[model samples]
Target chain A: MTNIIWGPMIVLYSFITGLVLGSYIISIAPTLFKMRNLEGISTFSMVTAWGFLLASPIPLVLELGSPLRAPNIYLYPTPSSVMALFGYIWIIFVLLLTTQIIIHSRYRDAAWFQRASTGISAIGLVISLIFGGYFGFIIGSMKAREVWSSTITPITTILSGITAGAALVALLAIITLRKDGLRKDALNSLGKLTLYFLAIYLVFTLIELSTTAYAETLTWTRLSILLIGYLALSFIGVQYILGGLIPIFMLATEKVRTSTIGSIVAFILILAGVYSYKWNLIIGGQQIVEVSPQLYSLLNFMPTQTEILATVGILSLSLFLYVLGLTIFPIPEFKSKR
Target chain B: MSKYLKLQEELPHIVGRYIDKKSAKPKWVMVVDLNRCVGCYACQVSCKMENGTPYEFFRTWVEVIERGKYPYLRRVFLPRLCNHCETPSCVPVCPVGATYKRDDGIVVIDYDRCIGCGYCIQACPYDARFRNPYTGTADKCDYCLHKIEEGEVPSCVINCMGGARIFGDINHPESIVSKMLAEKSVSVIKPETGNSPSVYYIGYEEAVKAGAPVTVINPKIGVVKEI
Candidate 1:
């Protein structure tokens, strides 16, 4: 009998890492690009990235059969595996984000600190881009799983991160800082940006599906399981229709883009869509059951009680840390700046 | 007897004189004669008893493929296990180097070192590896290494009802595996994967072609029998 090796925890890890990367990319807007309208949410998004980054590896550790032995990946790393690079990459990210957050909070008024923060942000920008896309590269490198083994996978992951990141920042701005003069114009601009990234993600997904349809041998069977088999409802309904198309339509119209409830609905849909994509890609790829040369079956995998509880616990911890960061740090007051 | 048979009998005697010295390492290989396999599943049962592998998880298993229509129906038994490849895909992907190949070409896992990340399980194209729920490490066929170390044949080889499985050192010219390699044409599964599998098959063309996507053959289309 065939059993699934990777579970929903892997999907959660990938999704959370993408959010950290995407949020960091959004944070770069005001610091590097000098987008004044984005300046209010810039520091807030950086804190979001930090909160999510701290929570990111928790899922990976929980998923391991032996959590203590995880450090062995660093101690006896094999160069051929991309997973081996994770230890070093994660440490570097922690150092850089810590320095960036310290500089922004302590010395925003000092010229030297401003210059130093800019330099650090530039480096942070480069690291975020690589780490964000590398999440996709991790799966894309697995040549055995045809649905995940695509050049488009990494690019799609990075784009989806940006879409999710923008939605998150918009959601936070509306919810927490709405009375602080976080304006409709700023949220509208962010909405427009989210719409564009969401559109590109949809296009990349289409291209991925089209090319996958022609894959030979075992890959063809995998794709068949995805498109026509058990995953059909989530793949078609939740991902394409509710997540992609509806959000795009809502964000396309100016009235809905500017309206508070409309923008919230669109961002929420984008988040759901991206999360669904991660689930379908990582978990769906492992669900293809090949018993022998001629025999193939599909195994059903849903998050168990332990898995769901662990995921929810990690995310709730991240949200708690984010709120703590907001209170302790000097996040720019939207109304004071206005 | 053939010249090779004479050599097979005499070589052990010649080698006995050098008992003080370390003997040559065996480069193990197995040959599965598809023509002789009778779908008895004795190998499957013997392997499980030998390994004590958990229920529903097998170190080796039997797969039966039914082909063609009612009057022309054919049932083929394909015994499946790890290829123990020369370049096993599962080896490099192991983050902790827990899985490695031996000097004699047997792929093994260091149970103590495996972190049970399950990467190797997915890397294998043959569907040969599995996550052992008990140990939480990757597990697969090792060609009955423990039994071989005791100078005994693999359980499946000895227990095979059809006498289909042949095991020996392929590097020795007089060995049964080597002789069969010279005398009979053989094929390996998924040759395009470039794994250079050691297990060779005879009359596996139909079995190889059966990899095309499975379809629902109508119940009335194939040969039917009442229980």
Candidate 2:
């Protein structure tokens, strides 16, 4: 029997990594572009990215059949392997982020440090963009799974990541920013960014699905399974309706965008939508068996209790670290001069 | 000297006696005659016993592909294993350089070095590789390398009751595999993958194309009752 090798753990890892990449972009973009509205949450976004980044690899390590042997990726580097590139990319990105955070916190007034931080932020932005779309490349390179082997997968991933990242930063900004410090325009900017990205993601997804359906190739059967079969609820219902349409509708309206509770609900739904999209991409991709026309039994796709616990546990640890970081680090007030 | 070291020293001489000296390196290949496969799964059972493959995992297995309908119904036994392709998709995608092709043309996994990332597993279009539960490493048929080094055929080849499985060095022009490949019309599974698989089948297209809704029978339980 064919089993789904990369399951819920992989889905969780991909989702978290997307968030880390997206948040890193949100953290660095304001200073680089000099967006006044986003500047207030720049440092806070960097801290948030750091928290998620630290915990991102946990699920991946835990998912490995031999966790201790993970270091072998670096030890016996396969230069040709796309997966081998992850270690190098991740380490470089982490170092860049750390240096930028340290410079901003400790050497904020130093002329050299300011220049250094800006240089680092520019480099980090490119790396974050790569990191955001890298997971999609991992899935895209797998020529076997038709659903994931599309050229558009990486673009969709980056767009969805940006959408989720903007939502998360907006949510946190609303919760943490003082009444005097908080900017309605800043939240509105984030909302507008999210709407645009989410719209693009939907368009790209529609193009992919429509083309696959029209092709009538071997991929069509698999696409059918995702569209109207076992994964239909998760793919269409959660990813599109609850996650995509509801949030887009809510964010589109000025009343909901300005209201505190309305924005919170929309952001939460967008996060859920992004998570569901990842789940469908990773877990759903593996559901189709290679040799047979038959899809893998639904029973095989269910995550084990350990997998559920590990996913929840890792997320909890990341949130804890983020909270602790906010308290430990001296984050300058939103209105403080740069 | 260690047994492996001693064996390594003696191996060339042992193989040289049986294999032609003109062909310095043996390019191993298998030819599966689908017409001769009797659906007896002796290769499947012997493979498990020989390799100690984990339950629900296989180094080699027989797939019963049901073709046609009504009076014309036929079950084609397609024996599946790692093709050890000329350009293996699994090799390039391995994060750790654990899986590689030997000079003699066998794709083997270095278990000690494998980190079990499952990237190679995903890259392989054949669905040949699997995670060895015991070793926590990628495992697949290596043409039974230990047996080959000692101048013996793979367990699947020797145990195949129908004599459908043929293993030999294609580099040697006189080898049975080379002769069959030259004389008979043979095909490889999923040639579209561009893996250029070493395992060639004699009647693949006719058997596979004459069907729809292909289902895989469990290799362990060889029984499939006629509908």
Candidate 3:
């Protein structure tokens, strides 16, 4: 049996990158769309996005067999390579985001900064969209893997990212914002955004699954085995029932959307759901062995101890950077200033 | 001298008669006669010894596929290696152009340049590539370019006990591969991929039919296992 080449590290890396794009969108939506509901937490969201962005490459580098040679991707880039293009895109996005954060934090009142911020936010939005879909494109382009080779893969990835990102922002906003500083309208808006995006993600996922099932090809057979066989609990039970349906129902109700505890529970579920989606896409896709009728034993693809450590370490690093940013940046007091 | 060396010595006249001078570069191709392959796995053993592929990793291997049931059961040996396609899927996905197709039509990796991200391994339709655990780089069969440059056939071709493998420059119309292509009905794997693989197989349809239950046997221990 051919062992899975890309494993859990790839899944985590994709998830973190999605979060980076999602948080960045939430940060800039206030300025770009003039959504005053997100205004209070805009700077906080940008900082969160920046922190995750800074930490995103850690898992990717750690996953490489020769980590020291990663710079070769930049030096000897093949233009035709989507992965090579991702390197350039990541650098450009990072620079744009950093510049936006600097301007928004330090020079918010300057007329020049405002104009530059608007232009940068517009560009950043496009880049984040690409960044969100980048991992999906990587998987989708591999024609050998039937489950991953779908036109809807990138769209589902972007929607999941937005849902997870909004949930993360909501969860953090509750934790960091002073009780008096917390605005009901902002939380409700974030809850509503998460609900809409999560619902869209669910619809696209169902469409992808149904389309795969509709075909009489080997794809459906393998996917059916995946859905009802070994991965049933993770793919259907957790990802759909607990993470997807429960959260959607919770967020849809005003009683749950307006309450701190209820919204927090829903956001946490959304985050878990998104992570499960990435897990299913990366690990579950690899489980369907192309050459053989038998699925690759999931036991083979379980993250090694080193992989698990690296995932935890990188997640901790992202959280550390976020906390550090909170301490270092002079984020204006949201209640009084905004 | 090997038969390939003898053929190489006669290449000038062959090229003069068959190939245009401007396009005379050797385009290597392999033709596997499934009819002749007896599942001896001499090629698989020789490849391991020659290339020093890491444990549990293969540069070339044969898959033993059994079809039908009970009285009608039959086994087919499907020998697999890199197709070294005219348009390779693995080539364009490399973040660092560490893997590329040579003008001679062999797909090769620059080991020193590879970061071992395994993207090429994932992109390959045939599962022909692997990340070398010891070297920490992507490695695969390159038609044994080192041997070929010295006017020798790949180790696998030379060691195939059943004479099932034919390796030659298709650019020379007089080459064995050209004659075989002209004489036999052949098929390439995953033609829908648009990779234009250089490797050709006789009896490909019967041996590699989709949904055929496959069993990979380890030649070393003669163990039958489903992979």
Candidate 4:
């Protein structure tokens, strides 16, 4: 219940979200472009990919009591600790293997490069599903937190990540389009994906809220806030209505099709909507009070200034790596760049 | 080289050794007689002083629970501590091997290696474990192993003015725990969990049979409900 821990929690969330974003991009990258695309695609893919590799390990390491002691998790595992098990294999299979894909891609169409990216992408998808589900499992397993204790939490969290990844790629597509040349049809494709992900996110959010509203407990004030308080307004109102609907409506408009201020506004909304959704889930989940008298006191606790500064420090690290990743391996645009 | 000659030589040493060492020591276990417990929580206080635990942080805890309806209310006090189970759940779940079950069946934590992840705290079904907020690692009762090593009783048992607690090893044939084990029927907490706890309670089955303080049905359902 120490407020200072929230700083690490933020680091934990942003890293996992970044990892989810990277995994999803790799999964759909092939279909994203038609003609041997190599420009902006490679840039963000490499950036987010390497970002994910670095990001996912940070929380697991920091969460450990003794960093050296962590080796025992893989050595003599309890088997009940599935997260520790999956995390060990995940760090090996997803990040390390994916790096090989980047290495061989430099040869461009060399048999190894194509085979590695395709194979690693497949492995990344599977590992991401397990590792991503684990993030939700940890929250849900807390019997003390009834709102988070539901089995569906893992599913909802997984869905949110995919939705964020798809929306992000769509936004990136819009940004890259503005800088260089563009096909009106490519924008339409991004517009289509943006709409698809929005629908999925909305459905899942509704199902979770509707079910929770019935069997809710007083201990679950955090969930109540996410559903009824100011944050809930953003989650359902901006995220579901304005954030999601506005993008779909703009995509349908003739002005958006022709590329105007309408397109820029829609892209910005998607970005805001996604980031806000992430913030609400991470911060909102922690605000709940456990019913124990011991923990009740912790519920009224406030964050000290040091905690805020630590959070800023963690965010700075993520940002710096992301920028470095962009510089080294820019996403691909068209055929000739490779 | 004759078998009868060698047997004769060994017999004197064996009998002499038995005569010298017999009843020379006592093995100790903590036995709580709950029927005599008044829920004063003096034991909880003594446990704190012995362990020097942080304020509101505990190695041993007690709960006073309500049962039945308002007018028919029955309040019962149950003092809870680490079972120090023969087969401990906390021992294996420690990713760093920080928790270990000793040969004598006491479960102990290696604070130096425990990284404060609180994983073991979550795994304990009896809520026997607590995360030491300052250290961020799991903490729990060790059956007062340090005191036992020093030939002293656990502070809680010594402080129990009602003499509700008895401490001795159940292993020695003539020890008080072994005598009680033979002559009386008693129970270990959550026997169904297969933890094979070292702490024994007299008159528990009677309390349970009367449906007193806590009714842990089928006490063996030690499935992954908590951890």
Query: Whose lDDT is greatest here?
Result: 3
lDDT of each: 0.79, 0.80, 0.82, 0.58
- The DockQ value obtained for model 3 is 0.44
Least well predicted 10-residue stretch by lDDT in candidate 2 chain B: B13-22
Please tell me which predicted candidate would have the highest DockQ against the true structure: 3
What TM value does model 4 have? 0.70
Query: For residues B1-227, what per-residue lDDT tens digits would candidate 3 score against the true structure?
Result: 99999998887445332223222678889999999999998998899999988777889998777765577667888899999998898998899999998889999999999999999988988778888878889999998878776677888887787879988888787878888999999999888888999999999888745464445443322343443
lDDT, model 1, position B109: 91
DockQ of 4: 0.15
Q: Identify the CAPRI category of the predicted complex in candidate 1.
A: acceptable
Query: What ranking emerges by lDDT with the best candidate at the front?
Result: 3, 2, 1, 4
The residue-by-residue lDDT of candidate 3 on A43-73, one tens digit each, is 8899898889888887788778899999998
Q: Per-residue lDDT of B92-200 in model 2, one digit per residue for the tens? A: 8888888999988899999988888788888888888888878888899998888877777888888777879988888888888888999999999888778899999
Encode model 1's per-residue lDDT on B150-179: one tens digit a residue: 665678887887878887777777877888
**How close to the true structure is residue A134 of candidate 3, measured as C-alpha lDDT?**
84
Candidate 4 lDDT over A32-148, as tens digits, reads 433233333544544554555565555555555455656656665555554456557566655554564466445555767666666665666666666656666665565534445
TM-scores of the candidates in the order shown = 0.89, 0.92, 0.92, 0.70
Fraction of native contacts (fnat) of each candidate = 0.48, 0.55, 0.61, 0.23
Q: Native-vs-model 2 lDDT? A: 0.80
Model 3: residue A144 alpha-carbon error in angstroms = 2.0
lDDT by residue (tens digit), candidate 2, A63-95: 777889989877887789877887888888878
Which of candidates 2 and 4 reaches a greater lDDT? 2
